[model samples]
Target chain A: MTLRLNLLIVLFLSFSALSFAQNNEIPAVDVKKIDGTTFNTGDIENDGKPIIINFWATWCSPCKRELNNIAEMYEEWVEETGVKLIALSIDDARNMGKVAPYVNGKGWEYEVYIDPNGDFKRALGVNNVPHTFLVDGNGKIVWQHNSYSEGDEYELFELVKKLSEGESID
Target chain B: MKNYSLLTSAASILLAFTLTFIGGELKAQQGIDDVLNNGEIRGNFQLEAQYYQEDSLIGAQDVPEKILSNGFLNLIYTNGSFSMGVRYESYLNALLGFPEGYRGNGVTYRFASFTQEKMSVTVGNFYEQFGNGLIFRTYEERGLGYDNMMDGVRVKFKPAPGLSLTGITGKQRLFFEYGEGIVRGLDAEFYLNDGISALANSKTQIILGASGISKYQPDQDSRYVLPENVGAVAGRVNITHGFFNVNAEYAWKANDPSADNGYIYRPGEALFVQASYSRKGFGLVLAAKRNDNMSFRSDRTEGQQNLLINYLPALTKQHTYNLLATLYPYAVQLNGEVAFQADLIYKFDKGSVLGGKYGMDVQFNVATANNIDTTMLNDERTTRQGYTSDWFKRGELYFQDINTQITKKFSKKVKGRFTYANLIYNQDVIEGKPGVPVIRANVGIADVTYKFNMRNSLRTEVQFLLTEQDQGDWATAIFEYSYAPHWFFAIMDQYNYGNEDPERQIHYYNASMGYNNGGNRITLSYGRQRAGIFCVGGVCRVVPASSGLYLSLTSSF
Candidate 1:
């Protein structure tokens, strides 16, 4: 057990050092808006503020919970840091019909888009939904986290605040 | 010995590079200004393991390999518009409910592609899906041990704005090797919003698309002659006007007898139509679909959710509550079925009667699927037409669900969500059981969240399902605690109190803890899992009963 733990630690440390530290803009991919308009996700910008990109699905419980939590403080977040939230539904054709209704019914004010074919998700190398990323104004991915606990939004909000204040998160 | 040496050499080289890269970071935090101008490397890894134990009461038995593990590592490198990636996957003895065919480990997926102006080409394994995947789709669902990505070449081209074309020729992946059949397909799409000047930015937008796919395989069966080559064609149209959007697709396939449809030499047909309208506070959507003998696969004899060339999703609500999902989840009827779904969403403004301080959101969805009315033709053996069916006629009720959910924020720190779902499921038809009666279940869920501080919170879920069919009534309670940025703990229990056999009534309990740091996470759990269908986005797999310890870790860089 000790040896295994040691090997794991070494592996983790090695990856942390050699891993890609890319400050890449969102890839140019065609995704549809709830209103049926097609837009390139890479063309989206925030005038040098932070953008919260969340990948979610209607069937993922954790995703809904995190989104709901963010909705409660969305107005304050926008007012305080000029941060914007973009929610992408990876629902596919099976439940693509429910994306619009589910979004409106949830009363979330975030900018919503549908990646019915998961083109954007694949480009980002996202393995699961509920994956959240903090993209800086320059379109560089500043930080990211997987999974959702009850209080995760607090951590995310703090990062947004920092990035908006011109604090170097990288 | 040769393979062992190759693996060792690869590991050493990787280790040396990592150490060299980290030498500078160890002394000083890598500055953003310092970036390698040459290229960029990124990847992710996930590892999951479970330790099993035997429990005779539930028919759970320990595997010879007590601890089974599955691991995946993906590495990608990019320079300008040119890029390459490879995925290494290992299934050490595989896991419960996972296909045992993936018992070993190797580099299962690899691809290299580059974009040059308006054209790009990819070589090696790739995932591609046509419009709504009615005719052809190649994808991977790792959790289900499903990966049928094509191996060969794919090309995507665009000569003008609003017009695009794609072509691919490949052999589908079957387990560790390529399948016997060869597949070729091409698709053309035209977008009016981009192509035509008058339609540009117009309230009305239209997109037209067509696709054709063909598969070739040598017939080996002597009992019945099978077509050496089968073809399918599909067409789709999508239009949007203001808040209203309409989309439809139809596909037709040449007759190719297979075991799935009892070797019936009848042409396959599928039609899908959907429309939706949405404004600020309200949205409405409706969809209809009909499928007849439309099971297409590269391998002729492949059955039971293997080597599927297309995806036919059930037009129904995808429930999340465990009981609501497992007991009556609807499987898309592949052979013959007609289905329809409708959804309505409304939001009551804040300060309104039902909105209180925070607005109230409500959504209701209803869907139903039934057998297509069919009658056998005269001289069934001689007539190539297996059966006659009306496009719109509906027969027995295979599945039905009506669910509604409401969300309201009562206070600054308290938020609640409530849901009610009623389902009617035909167990015999869906589960392929002969005598089981239809199951009717009503389920309710109350979820509440409490925030005590800036960094601390608690969430609770109370769910109850009432039914006399299946395993009787079930109730579940879950509580979770989170400390922002770092830690989370949760406990849940499902009690089957209404089981017919009192001795069999038991509590399925689980507890878990998670630690998160940046893009990395690790979770440890111990639990008793009940046998049921575990689903994600309407796709499901049967998870056998088990008592085990689970560990999962994922990291991205």
Candidate 2:
């Protein structure tokens, strides 16, 4: 027990010098669109509105639930806050072909793309699915989270509302 | 002296990385509003440890190291279109079921990349895949102790809007070192919709791709002359019209002999196809595939799942429920198999009879795999070609799964889902244990959630599985409660009800709690885990049987 504690403490101290400042530019990487064209993720321009990027897959049940929940209120959220949601599928070739059909069947109106090779997922250092990022008007990632439960969408909408109103979320 | 030198060099590199990251952080902290367009540093860290106990009946043994830990830190630096990254990994004695070779710690991965105009180049280590990974793929899955990254140079050129060419030459990584063979590959993809004016702006679009790979290894056998150079080639096409799409790929390999195939010089072949039609509130998909002697690896003597140059994902649904996942999981039979899968998803309109006040969603999926019919040749013992397989013939059933699920929202704050599955698993063929009777299982699950308020929720899941073979029937239940954006707790228990031996009918119980705060999470659990195959994306890893406490942490910045 003592040895494990010591290792934990040492690991903690090594990274104690800094906490993440969420004000960093998004990693620039190539992700493909539904039309089979590639574009840089950092080039996404939403006319100074906030953009919510969600990393999901066709097989993950929790990811689908979260997307469906958000999709239920996406139209209202966009109308109220002018936010744009971009759903990025990290599905490899095994299930990459199912991504489009799955999303369309869910009746989601968000812009969807495929990270067929996990390039963007790796660049962003995402460890799991249902990872979400909130970017400000200047393309700086302002907040992020992983995983989701029921009623998590309201928390995200609150943050989007704050950003749209030009107020600090933290 | 050599070991000491390697350790010192590795320590110095890690220290240097820490210093550089600290300096970058200090500069950015100096001015809150100052943006550093010159460079930026980002990274993530994960640590997992477990304590084990022995159970003779379950086959779990005592750990020499009572506590084993696995950890890694990934650091990446990016500037405009240029980027570089390194990964440091450590396994202190390694956890149970992981590769014993990874018993120490070091920097295991490094790479640098730059892109200019329509061309890009990467030097050092990189991961890549080609057209469904039928012919070539390099990747990593930490939980499975699998990493086959390439160590060399890769370049990509896109001279035109619809055409792309990629070339790579390198040696694959085997554990802590490089494989003994050299691998080279080239791939090209062209989008006909963009290249041909007639297809542009039409309802139909077409894309075509091709890949070729070769590995060169020195011949060491004195009795039989081994082929020094082996080649594999693949071609693929994708076509899409309004509300419908079709994708297919075919791959072929030269005569190659290896340990996994009893050293038979049989050429390999693989074919995969998928079609789907989807629109609002409705979707359907069908898939078919066949693989024959398609195990291509860099080293001829290697066995098990290591140093593979291609991937063959099972054309079956990746289950999520614990009982459905752990009870009778399926792994791809690489030698030869024919598989088919179909899935359907539909949602009923709100306020309708079945839709209720909210809405109802239904999904159905079925998958089956069978052995490919083949006949042994009279001269197969010493001939170059081992056997011949009939193109359209299937021998015997290998596996099958029929699953149906329904989801409905009862109210604004209440939702429920129900699922049922029936499976047929052939342990004799897939698990290589002949004479063992086939295992058939049926599973049912119900999950419900209720929201007490905007920030709090409670969820419950009940699952039951019945099987006549293997360990018998089992029942599982889970209770979870969460406070949005902060904390959650869960408790679960799985009971073996139908075991013949009453003493062995045990409850695998566990309790866990986690805290989350903006890209960071820590979870602690104590429980008994049964031995089973834990898989992600169809690739599986064995999780040994053990009873212990586990701790995990993940954070990114």
Candidate 3:
């Protein structure tokens, strides 16, 4: 048993190493538009500009706080970096009916989608809400953040600025 | 040795298949480039460990295993139209408050799937849900240690642009093993505006969905004749026009004697309806639900959130405030209940009277749940028929809450929120505590934040709960400081000041800090926890009080 376990671990490590050497792009998963139409995550794009994907839910307080703070400076961010924000709500059927109304009441201008079944969320390996991902112009995921603090949006904006300028960010 | 050999062969076969695919791609198309460039791999990991200390005062018992931990890792690989994944989970003796069945380490979940144009198929483990999840839903809630995933075959076909059909047959996962009953389901959905060209330019949009699910389990009881096959069906409709939207679903289940309903052969039914209207800056939603013996489970004897085949949505606002959320939290009455909720949100524009320099957001919500009226039948044991219920009649109130909140920016560097709630909790019913009186409470909270710079901030919260029963009245205060992109620290104390027993009046104090980097986070805390019912989406579990040191780490790539 131990030998078999060791073999499995070694095989997994090797595969991980090989995959890590290549660029990671977004996975294809189906999500729902606010209008109830199916939308594929692979088709998400912003004309070669940087794209920000934020996983949020109507019941999550930290997610609401993060989105509300970003809404205050979203226009400025777009003007400076030409970036687009995609807000994905992981609300299940119980609260899905409230998502559009909740987003509209907040007056947020970001493109919104619904992942009622959490397909896109699981595909992206998001364990919690308020998880943010920054995808570069070439559609390669560059940076990601878990959880949210008061000023985390500023750090996210900084990355967006760097990516828009074609500068490498680590 | 037999299990080891089987697993070894499976791994070897998978490795060989991958290598063969790589070789084939290299020979048929570009050399080695397609294999590396077209495939993507991603996964996540999480670990939580806690060290326990015996504190009899708070009802925390001694832990034989002084330290316990839970860990999970998920890995997925995708190439073009094909993808596969596996999850490894370990619970060293299982954590406190978690299901005991989750012991040892193993690969609990694995699946391979492929999609080509309009059809997709999954042949291993999968999660699925029908409309509103009224009749069938297989999912995982890691926080609750609840996972009822299906292990079988599923196929989805989208014959048209706006129409989708799905079929599934499987057995539910019962911890490390599979349930005895087999489940089969079929679902279909149609988007009228997109499916029919005549409605392509229509202002109103409509979506229709229907599903039917059945479970098969052999009857083995000698004293009673039990159902061998039980089936349920549900239908849903969603309509949207301009700023108005309405959605509703109704489900019916055939009679199947189970432990949840006391082995009474009663047909189950449920109805859920929601309507909303919203534009920029203002929104309103109204929802109502009715359930009658709607506790559908695959096993006749299993209980406590196991083998559940449907979800009963709690028609109430999911409160976030500490005092409002934890104290007197309501759980759905699976046996029978009627509930209603109303919510309104409006934002006063900047420069307006209530808006001032910065706009003010106001939210008001009210929700209530009551038992369904039922009359007992005379048949004691011969027929097993339970009772007849009045469809629209309301019985005793189980729970009620009215709450409101206002958020505003006081100045350039200051923002604050104020909230108040009035709650009526029927402890005897909601908590299953016999002889307990109905408790009424009032709660108020003030949360404020001060921004020092673009990268630094401080936040504080003061909350108070006034009640005359149970824990009496309580007060809590919290403070947190954050240096963005990296570090955050928080401390909190909750005092049961108004407890009738002086010796039981204790203060629960805790402090924690965390560091967050891209896709990685680690946190450590030491605290005294209070015993309470923790719930997510109406499903709940009792969390015992404990004093402990806790650590958590999570990362994704």
| Tens digits of per-residue lDDT for model 1, A57-169 | 98888898899879878999999999989999988778776777677666688988988766677677677778898998788887888888777898798889999988978
Ranked candidates (TM-score, high to low): 3, 2, 1
Report the TM-score of candidate 1, chain A only: 0.86
Q: Cα miss at A56, model 1 (Å)? A: 0.9
Cα lDDT tens digits, model 1, B503-554, are 8888999999999886788999998888888777556778789888999988
Clashing pairs in 3: none
> Which has the greatest TM-score?
3
Ranking 1 against 3 by DockQ, winner: 3
Per-residue alpha-carbon lDDT of model 3 for A1-170, expressed as tens digits? 77567556645554656646546688888898876667899899999999999999888888999999999999999999999999999988778888888889999999999998778888889888889999999998999999999999988998999999999898
Over 4 Å off in model 3, which ranges?
A: A1-20, B1-37
Instruction: Name the weakest run of 10 consecutive residues (lDDT summed) in model 3 chain A.
Output: A10-19
Candidate 2, residue A106: Cα displacement in angstroms equals 1.3
lDDT (Cα, tens digit) per residue for candidate 2, span B165-224 = 999999998888889989899999998878788888878888899999999999898766
Worst 10 residues of 1 chain A by lDDT: A6-15
Residue pairs with backbone atoms closer than 3 Å in model 2 (clashes): none
lDDT of 3: 0.87
List where candidate 2 sits over 4 angstroms from the true fold: A1-23, A35-37, B1-37, B55-58, B378-380
